[model samples]
Target: MEEDTDFRIRFSSLCFITDHVGFHGTIKSSPSDFVVIEIDEQGQLVNKASDEPIYKVNKMLPEPNNLAKKTKLDRQNLSFEERSNQELSTLAGCSDGDQIHAPGSEKEDTIKDGTSEGEEGNIDVLGSLLDEKTDELLSQFACDVKERWDSKTELIGPSPEFSLGRILDKNQRTILHSAIRQKFPFLVTIGKNSEIVVKPNLEYKELCHLVSEEEAFEFFKYLDAKKENSKFTFKPDVNKDHRKAIHHFINKKFGNLVETKSFPEPNYSADNPSVVITVRFREKAHKHRKRSLLECQERKVIYTAFTLRKENLEMFEAVGFLAIKLGVIPSDFSYAGLKDKKAITYQTMVVRKVTPERLKNIEKEIEKKRMNVFNIRSVDDSLRLGQLKGNHFDIVIRNLKNQINDSANLRERILEAVENVKNKGFVNYYGPQRFGMGRKVHTDQIGLALLKSEMVKAVKLFLTPEDLDDPVNRAKKYFLQTEDAKGTLSLMPEFKVRERALLESLHRFGMTEEGCIQAWFSFPHSMRIFYVHAYSSKIWNEAVSYRLVTYGSEVVEGDLVCLDEDIDDEHLPSSKVHLVTEEEESANTYAIRQVVLPVLGYNIQYPKNKVGKWYQEVLNRDGLQTCRFKIPTLKLNIPGCYRKILKHPCNLSYQLIEDHDIDVMKEGSYIDEATLSLLISFDLDASCYATVCLREIMKHDF
Candidate 1:
């Protein structure tokens, strides 16, 4: 009898309770009308003369047929803060007494004698009982971010541009799901009180279609449900938090690509005795670990790790300058890959026969250059590009407000995001690092200009500083823009060595446009190659985006599939992409494990289908042809290469740490008191980026 009575009470409440009851006018509610109250961040309720928590009486509407009716009043009086414009629009065309069907309710035809057939309607369902204001805030925030990134991409970058919606969807699927499931995608130990338990309402999806405007509405409610149930308190709208986390992840990871060169495996004669053979993957079932002895002498290679703190220089530039200071040429120095200057990057570098004393002095000199060498050791071989197995990154992301203080629910939500990423990894489009992070001018743009023989434009864009905030660089850029090449040479700063060299060449050749072209070629071979590579990388990124959106992970006929995982090595400066044959294409027995796309070059043979058509279309849209990649003027006959359609970071790990843990004081950086941060660490194979891993985590497009 008691259970029956409880059910009756619940059923009665459900019939009358609507999540967003429209108010007739601007009248505010007294504290007596609300059963419970919570304060907003501004600590204001009703602004006229309010000190107490003024509540809005959820003005209940009378039920008409299945739909609720708003009180007779002009909606024109409604303020932005109190308006539900979308909801109001749904109630249009219905007269005062006409029958109306509520959202998720069965049509009159579908319902017979007050009983619906098939699944029951979701009217007044538990999942629908979310705070409308919070839902609106979250959704609006998400939409704004998506629109912003999309607009920015349309202006300066390649087409098939970055999609903020797709990124958010990916993040929601990967990171968020993992966190909620309490399962890390890659294995790791959990921190204290990291998990939050909650029951999800599975019936919500059937009730109504999630609209584009309400992209984040359901997520906000999902978090709100826990708060209402007193399971744990978390902010209903985490838009700010989401943005910070996304941008932070982007700045740290997805901002760069690691380009390397391919070389043959080391060969040694059997007579040599100093070399030892090591098994890469040993079986645990074996009685004893097996090993093979190889004959070779250890090369004098000094492996050193350095942290770059400034953003003004690229990795190769810093290493080259360091070599010059050490009285040796840059050719004497070798490194696995270049690290990003925009970050506090720690990476390995190798130099032969450099004494410990000299290396220590070099380290001290680097400190003056806003860099620090933290580790140095002797290795048996020279560290060629892509020699290292992978890079392990420990990144500290700051200024996230959503998860600040005791926001356990926010943390739980983040964990959920992380969980989503763990199950199915993200699409690995090359980050902004593959192309330079210039606002008006990108490296790929300059490269494309070079390919099209737009030397004057390329030279101008190159001299135009990416960071306009720097007055010195900005002034120098202005001089280059307003003055002739001859005059600009005198105005160029001493540090603007590349720009000065180009200007000098122009002046030397009578300030003619041909001199500008020759001047561009005079830069370091490493730097010149980078521009062409950037163009190729951009094509690869765009192709990957198109492939994932159209065909997804499934393989189709005429698709150029990669036969081996090692196909990524073909991306090396010296190699090219090799697609499977028609016989292989005919055999559909193999799983669609890897799809590789080609970077444009004369040697590139595009897939003979929609994929190939897309490649031609993209090139055509850029007003160029694949043959242009073999330009004689630039001497850049960059061969086509392959990039894996998807990348999953290996050994991924992350933890949300306190701001106090970061040493911002050393750099005189001031962190917001309300900010929360994350310390994410992960490892990626050579040429695979840590930023890509972060993209999987945060899902922010730009």
Candidate 2:
């Protein structure tokens, strides 16, 4: 192993998300399950790893048979709702349509479900009763109307009348299949043999009905409470059949629990009922925190993780909150909670209306404290603290009062503290602001206010894209136009209307050059094709591709040729070390990745910008038509990696493309922002070590 000259070439730089946005399963593409590749200085290939060549390795499960449908599998079972199909004369299946939940606006937008707005409580009486023949009841059902904004599309919008899916990621597919094994639950099936399959034609909102908090809570609360008391303590108050159905749903959704029983007193009631109720069940039976994390996003989402550095302390929440405070996060933003001010912590956070840079700038402008911004990453609307399902933390503690607390005592205390925090939930302590040395306001009060504010921001993500960590990644993904890659599937007709619109909204707040665009996300790329008014026009109709189109003037593609055009002289294509090989050459041929994105006649290219002036030149040469951009950069000599000895000379001229393969996304969906953060793979590792060695991560004892 040591014999290999280049480690980067020899070993893989594995990025484990430990968290990310939900799978775009229905799109028939997932970032996970693909392969990996590494590039060199001139954008040459340094290494490659193809995880899976044949996409959709697991085909969709086959349709169930009458005799086969009768018996459910062991790890899976049908909900009582499906069992009622027995009374139906015919199995009224679903139709072909997109699965869309009506979207709600920020101020007073309401979800367009059969359930009532504001009064989600009355859903029990307002929504139609579950029936085997969904075609019948859905025909009569209408979603509740409420005040809403015309801002943008939404997630929980009115459920699509019809939609079908091919088995994509086996993980999510299995979740859906296990939820309802019998009758086709939304046509999603997991065979008794564990294959994920879908029916061609489908019926109405049965899947939505399964996760609907209203019906789920009603049955499970009763079952959970009864199980807690004694045996067979069945009650007839809440329809017996309904009780069984709820029990079954809970088992599937929350995993299996101890002998199920109905709650003696329902969380919902006749008087004033709460729209949201936190039910208590045996902890052992609990599951779905990860699956349901995204569901709770409508409630509020926040993330907090950190990276340590000596000369600088990275406070992720502070940066995120400051961005929102400055009004960038128009929708809203928040942290799961705050961290100790002295510690260097890097974490992902969400807000309804903040830009990534505004978040990064908070750290940038604060050089007065001998601290500088190390680096920060972004997440989608679905990214939150607990929502991450897991966390990757890098911290440093300093100025320890060794005499005040011994290592043994401190260790004991930290472990106990962690256990207590997890069990009872943190103190909800107000962040540094509570005491930011301001007359000592009660921490709880300030913390409560932050919580409320964060929730407001979280609920607002519903109006926009589910996630956006790598702005550069977004442009590259969209621009690369490699439809073959699963990540680019968003370009498909089904997603264009919504996903594209969201990208445009983001572009309005960021910058782009050619097919390569950069946001505060900070993606690392050796070279980028340049374009003016790239998203709107077709200037590079033959040269380079446009990353964004709605706001762009063109989609252009071209070679990242040498900077032949000296600012001193107007001639381009100079002593440029032409990347195109003799066999693959045509003075840099541009391919139209997506006809939707224009390939403009843009020709500005650079391995990396030496100064902001280069960007200004693109703008000057192209005028205002040239978009503005911001990117974080780290200049480190990466150890060269190896590639299998095959193929022609390494073509380092690799243009950025959307990671469309499932293998690339398996760890988690890599959004533009997420990808950009990866660019900072090497930066001040020495400083990071210094902080940790000094014990600077500890907080000021309250």
Candidate 3:
């Protein structure tokens, strides 16, 4: 009843009541006629009328079938009732003009005789019933996010391509049903009441058909694109959040040809073997006593406990939501951020620490096999959201260019870059997710509009429900629109009127006070913090200084270069893409480096001829001890003295080796010239045995 308070009649009808006097002599009627037209909640017709209900007068239409010529006085009004929809489904028929039956009643045509029958009627009835049920279900629906999947091979970095798949949620199922149902095939989630809810009136099949591969991208909303100066690189859309997908995708294409390398078990001998659990599962007899909360203390025994994967966060949230639906209060639980579905992830969840019977009952609801326990143990308390800090990313890169120019140099550069980032810092730019790619611009625009609307509401409206064209609404809308362009146009009225006025006002009175006012208002986090922060400064400064011209990648032809030299607007394909030359393709690369050995100062012997401080020190301290003790010289002619070589995927090696007399060492070794000649001389204190691969490129065209 309380819920129905908000429900009002949507359709109107008239109830006719006739009052006739049976006169034998003369037929006479009242001179004036009176009628009453119904009013809505506020006693107004569509809220346009005055507060008072209006009365009307008009001649009444006589009932056609009544030969007595009886005039009808009708009251127009909206009718409604509070009743369960269950009765509507049970209904087998509706009044067909006061039970007027077809001439085929005797033929037992119940449908024609105002009774629901036959396949057509049954189909209609079923459809209606389904419609009602669907509506009832949707009314109670909250929020639902879909888990996407891939069906074909996907290539990820460091691995060969492999196959992809997915698992969907119920709302996705609903969308699928709706799409496959009737006239329209798409089910769009519309924004309202600060939430995105699915549109109503879609049939089950209609919704179902909407579960499509291409259509799914429509769900991503748009956002405003930053200016050209900003480093807004696009991030590829990761379908389904499947972590192992890229590896699988890569493996598929080159799996048969590429030989598999043996992955031996780790050689670390654990010092703390006690941390390992000997028994993973326990039998019923060894389990603890348990009871369910729903039953009387003595009546209910704990059923059993089961483990869930702790890996996926969504699985945890799903299980939690499912448990709430099943009236089961999880006694114990633990999880990290929602893990990707379809991936074999591990998580921990516990039912009440009750007996086997009660646990069994709840465990029946735990449906997913992937969710069961890997190992069960007593954790101090249930693990909540974001308990884990980060993940260990393991990767493998394969199928690189065989003949890479300066492979050693390139490898060093990449390794150095990685080390540089790890040591110094990375650009604190936003990840490439702010822009919605793959999704059509319309979706992104809508999202941007929504964001702008919210910003306007927060900044301008604050709280109000006035006309959108009102000064307050207009002011809020002003903030929502983009603030670029040299001058406002005078063509259009709706938007131009405001723009032109604002432009004139700006010209006459200088910039709007709100710009400064808004800045001041946005200060705490937006002004003071952002202004003072190095990250913001870096972001803006880098934006101002974006450059990418390498030493020799220049063009001699007429080049329509942009103001920013590296970013030429007229360049073929545009600078947004990382364009590499055909030669560079044979040697595509990025780099990183790690210094395992810390530098401790230099160990310098008298260069045999130095006039520096060391020489001066020796001269002063030892009183010119010019005795040639041979400097304890080490002829140290070590033949075949090659340092240990460690192989890396990119095929480059580095090591510590003895600094030497280049001429003597070059002539001293007895190894083959080919391998021996490759050993370049290093004039450093530390030595290195570098294993280099002369990367060779081969392209096959059959």
Candidate 4:
């Protein structure tokens, strides 16, 4: 039980088996007994086999070549006793039955007496042996990832069942959990209070190792602290459950509005619905533009709304590409908010000083890229940031697995959930989409870098390709990793023309830190600002979640609550952050109907209460200050804004489609063994997310 000084075992300890594809078979002996091979620059083993590298971390391995092999050969020529003491070293995982023989040695590859190489005459027998469970445990550890070619040959084939083996970071335990859910979907119910099946006979050492504890007592203590019990056959979800209470409160508060209404039979699943979104403006009376070819357009600012379906293009990127085709800079076009790149988005955008004819040409170019399924109509005024009322969402959630119960009960449960949302609004937490989607670099990291004035790091993070499968972009990132700016620029593809421009700036301005900051300006101002705003959104969401957990559903005396519905923006309430006076507190008029939270900024005056204190703690945890939001050097400081701590969709409605055609679904598509699906449609004020509402229903299931 003493601390194992085995380097290989220590390396394995740093990895998780459920996260990767290691040696698939069971192994009982220490990894030190196996011949470890070094990997070459090409990510291949330096051996006669010339196999691909498997381990992700083995920095201690010698450089890939025949030098280590020659050294081993030289040692082997010594007496049998000398050869037995010096075993060959190579980098590979070995199961119990697997064999690792020296390239030229005539001896059999077996572990006798716990020693790797045995004496020529007789090997001593050691009582230390690996059990079947321990062997299985050794195989699951994610000590290494194989190269693409090797994975196809040595492990699971390409496109392996659920993309389960790929582990991105050590903090990520969810991938393994996700794989378990995918395999046992029926046993898992996702949401706050989600549950999963637990195997009762798991080994004590396995559990201890998984929990990163050395002692069985400590491991059981950790499990007990988490309230895990062996008698409990299923793991229950422990998240907050306020839906029923909220529904009850809404019935009492808004009695008549809680009436049941019949809904039309939906044609799509709420998950994989064909979305039809239209951006609504703050100004209802805003006039549409007419053709004015006779005179130069007086309105230099042009606002346009366009609908795009499954275009797989970012709103700004598409518009910016169109602008380039029209011989204009990307910055010429501006939008209030970015829309989903993979959905049918009808969004509004602004372009400065463009004729209606020119706008049509730009639209035509965009249409060509979007498979000609789009509509771009120019309006009179430019769309200002935060100028939209809200977006109207027509979303379909697909593959409704609700047929286990009677149809009536399923329908009732869905209707009840929808009704609760319509009346009691759920927590207005920022959806995960607020953060970058599928990007290697997180939005918060870039924002923190900028706040800390690490301009070069921020620039590299933004430009570097995250997904290594993308060979072209991967090559571009490789240059950045090697600090070869010129090479990166030369290899940068046309799709990354913007990144190439930034790289060119780096090459021209010199590779100094200041040069990198100047080059960062090459990216669109909107995109750069979005990174900073992402941090703000994260802070706001965290604060709201903290407030909900701390104060529960009721408002305390010092809480910042919403005043009235007269405020157009439900999220950004017109009511100020007010401290509840004794009179208002006693009257219960200022009770927590809705809370307002701050997005960190220089101008944002955080509430002088517990909520404000949480905000400060969040900032302090990251070594950031509110005052740092004003980055004068970069001229990119953002004044803070307030966001609602809770939001309810206006005119909430939904239709559950029973036995809907599984084939009709194209977006958010999922395989539905169940014939039924759901179609949910709702409207929310600008800056609110429909997905947040859906999260209230689906929870972690989404």
Candidate 5:
């Protein structure tokens, strides 16, 4: 393959690890072709279901209410007859013993005018029909009904049923039925021969059979018991919708205290399977069992950690989708590092104040977006950037372009290249992703302008468009030509978040230098840091290239190297790096791979050699000095650190195959007999670019 001049000058990837003959192949033909899995600090691989002992919890708990206390007090104070009259009048939607009257309509007032002569005669007859024993019995029944309603304990049993025994007179029975209907709207009355039977209505019966909020807490307590028999099983006979409602109710009310599992009962049909819900205390809940329910709620878990596996989606896009579905902002989530947008990547993500169940609930939704989440568990803290040991890659390169006809010869060449990378490593240049692609101006240009305090230039560079055809570019053009923020925003696409945000701010704050600066600063901290970080990365890449070209991968005097004790597997802080002395270089204490380069910052130390001098020269060319990194107005400071100049792919291996090997060919398609594919797998340290390693093996730019 020929060299790419743009790649060399732009990205500063000037050299390769080996001059071995290589083959050409296409990458990312499909999302699955490039797989990346994160390795955590504990050296454990993060994959689907790889993490153990998942700690599950409900999304939220039922909020506490004082209804029970208020009901109890009211019941104690009011007599049965008076409470019944009040309740009946309430059910009838009228004042006690008064007919519902239309406002502003003239009618005979029962209370103000006193009872009419005809009403008095009917009242007299009804009073004569009633007896003291019957009235006493009815009042006792009302008391029982009130007690049962207040307790709310008979959730899984039969409905509250009572029999009005053997009424001999039909007028008395008819009057009794009317009274029962008025007093207890929740109950239904039936005439069984000479007897009257009263039971709760079907709707009320269904509600009673389902779990209540108070009963959920009781079930939680029962499961939380330390005894051997701590468990609760709910076997309700209901249709599919009712069963689903029961499940949702239990999950919402129980919270994190209990775990519920449902199974289809034996001899049940698929259309409407009888669900048996088994509830037990989660293993972690036992520690908080002694605490009160309020205390437990107050001490609910803080963070939920899970594996997020996404295909062909950028980190921000994936997080944004999740935030919308999970009812949270994107900032609520944190991951160790961003993965490739065109790969099937798996990494650990931690979310604040989220339950494992909430994360699990979105699995179907995320899966529809070609992503998935699993191995959900509660954690005490969030994952920070650079928290992982490394990343594992499984890459397949297809449609190889090579002159070799023999498969054996191609395999031998691929093995040689793989061995070269494993032994000598490759130049550690930041990938193209660090620098925004296909833009009219590079991100580093904006960063340099900011460092030099050229606010207007930086704003112009940010708003300028690469082309006028696209919607976002047209918006940018409109804004630049007319300074019409609203009109520009009208032309802008919603997905161009940063562009739209700047336009929105300009619309409100006016299109002035001060307004632009304020709008720029209003961006999220991560986004604000991104441009400057890209500038630092560009400087580091150039420095690494210069170091390799001049010294040829040898440890030189005045080069900075991290002490063994202070060297971190994940990151190298500036404080740990030490300048190589003449004696240290003479003794050859540090290898070429151990040398580090600074990513220009105010607090970092420069090399004591010519390479260090080159760093200042590069910054000077951009009208930037290291001290300018400290922006007091923005409350921004870059305390950058050292990075290794070389990285070797660990456990590297490769295989060569043809299209027919995987049995993915179409019946009528033609096969390229001359072209073969390469499959490689390896692990890279955190912050290391796998594409750079591949560049060494293939001698091709990504």
Candidate 6:
């Protein structure tokens, strides 16, 4: 065959490992011509065949009780003192003397009547400040908080704040604080400048630790110095035992951010020192720290896992259609990886919060859409990308007579190619799908623009016309000429989702630099990352080609090799590899097939040889530095990984079929009666592109 000069080959690599003559043929002539079966991490084939029953809700795991709703109902039925004692018991994990008193309770009435042992001289001096109207308003506020607490329904406006007129005497202020705490323990009272203010308590208690009032005050002062928000406060005075109980309550209810500490009153002459406790932020507290204990308790099997078989449908398109039918967003669905759009593929899929019955009911609609789902079951965890072991391919290459002389020649060529692959393997270069097919502007170009922090250029490259006559192309051309996003959007088809989204965002946000960047970001995270990953793949392909040309099939001194021979998955990150040392290479510990090349990223180590220097040359040619991998503005951090230089397909096999033996060929079809076809079947590790393998076998541009 003449030297291939395709742009994709130049962009990636044109190197082929095997020297055997490759026969020409066409693959994916029909949807049935290509087949893919996903293999799960357990080494089990994820195919359409399943013995599991049709999804039913009864077959799912039982759900836990709704504790929040039950608690809300119980709180509504309890009296003020009963509720306080109950909450204290449940939250503090204690009872008895820990109970808080309500107003008019025996303890409070005794203090009010000047009949208590220690408070005989104390009287209700602040009685004039507490009018019946004030008491009613405070009670109403408490009721509102109670009703909305469990459900987290937003309270209208801000929390209600009650202001008490200045009381000159400390004893009178203390009396008022005690009265409020006894009546509404959920409310917090703050005393400043002889004035008292009361509001509903909304404190956090994560990582609680005791600190003195002075320490708490100093921490707030430090925050003021740094101009940070002081999200902490001191609580009203309480007895020593009550302070300890309050600490437990704060820890259990608020989760450790807020802490309680009791200290002696300054310059007190009494035999027993008065105790004052304060709640304040920890020294370096995070506002939204994850609590593993709470997460474990809340985790449940709310996701449904099933196998989906799709024909001639893109993964995203299939997922989007299912999401619409299931009344859920596309984000609710998760899969191991994307499959070929033109092939019949069977892969595992997961959907969150959808019942098995709901999934089963959509079977008819799914079948109408040329898709099948089976083996539905409830799983605690959702399927994640790169979770599969590999994929099994059953591909048919037809029309081999156009290149081969006869059936014998085709069979001999295919057998030689398969055998060569089984032994020497083929270069693991990225396929055309990574850069997109038949597009004027490749995805890698946009990725390069993004890495350069040229958002406008990236956006323009993305919107560049792929064809001169297609409706989507026309719309893109119109926008490029006039920059009228609204007008262009009207001409764009709804099926062109990413294009429509970019136009919609631009129409709303205008066509400024920030707007263009925002429009670029409007694409889904996977779509955005795919472009950058494509660029990385391109560089990786060229590097692998260079390594092969410079060092042939030799295990070089500075090459990186996989440390674990048992690691069947090639999709593992760079952490699995290490540089081959002189000692290891001398001992022949690692083979050339075990060598790995770096994907361009910030978090990877390049080869320690001249091949590493070649990477820098490639990056410089593309106007990129390693620092560009860490784009903080776009939040695009590419942690570069490693991929093996070559891959040997597992269970490789092939057969030559004549036109008469082909079931799909019709009697009066235009195809030649003596046409030869090759049936190829093989298994590849995760992240290995099957099309690249086919390229090695056929030496044809797809």
All candidates' TM-scores? 0.49, 0.18, 0.20, 0.53, 0.61, 0.63
Query: What is the model-wide C-alpha lDDT for candidate 1?
Result: 0.44
| lDDT for each candidate structure | 0.44, 0.26, 0.23, 0.45, 0.64, 0.66
Report the lDDT of model 6 for residue 500. Answer: 73
> 1-702, model 2: which lDDT tens digit per residue?
011121011001111111111110111022121111212113322122223211122221222122122222221221112211222112112122221111211112112212221223323322222234542343232121101111223326443332223434434333332222122222322122323333322222332343453442233223322234323333334354445454543333332233244454546576533232223333332233675644444333232122222122223333433432343321233433233344333333343332334445556544444333332433333333222211222221211122243434333343343333223221111122222322212222222222222222211221222225454335334543432222433443331322332233233222232111112112111101111111111122111111221112221232233323221111222243233333333432422211121112233332221222333343354333333222112111212111110011111111112333212222344344222111001111100121111111122222
Please give the range of 10 consecutive residues that has the lowest summed lDDT in model 2. Answer: 678-687
Instruction: Indicate which candidate wins on TM-score.
Output: 6
| Model 5, position 475: C-alpha lDDT score | 79
Error of 4 at 698 (Å): 1.6
Model 6: weakest 10-residue lDDT segment is: 73-82
Off by over 4 Å in 4: 1-310, 362-364, 371-381, 402-409, 568-575, 658-673
Regions more than 4 Å wrong, model 5:
1-8, 50-301, 403-409, 663-673
Cα lDDT of model 6 by residue, 460-479, tens digit:
87888865798988998898
Clashes of 2: 115
lDDT of 4 by residue, 435-504 (tens): 6644556666677778778887777666667656665677556766786777776677666556765775
Model 6, position 439: C-alpha lDDT score:
69
Candidate 3 — what's its lDDT? 0.23
Q: Is candidate 3 or candidate 6 better by TM-score?
A: 6
| Every candidate's CA RMSD | 39.1, 28.5, 41.7, 33.6, 22.9, 17.7
Instruction: Return the TM-score for candidate 1, rounded to 2 decimals.
Output: 0.49
What is candidate 1's lDDT per residue for 522-618, written digit by digit as tens? 4644566678777777777666666665665566666666656664444433233345555665665344446667777766677766778898887
TM-score of 5: 0.61
Give the clash total for candidate 1. 22
Ranking by TM-score: 6, 5, 4, 1, 3, 2
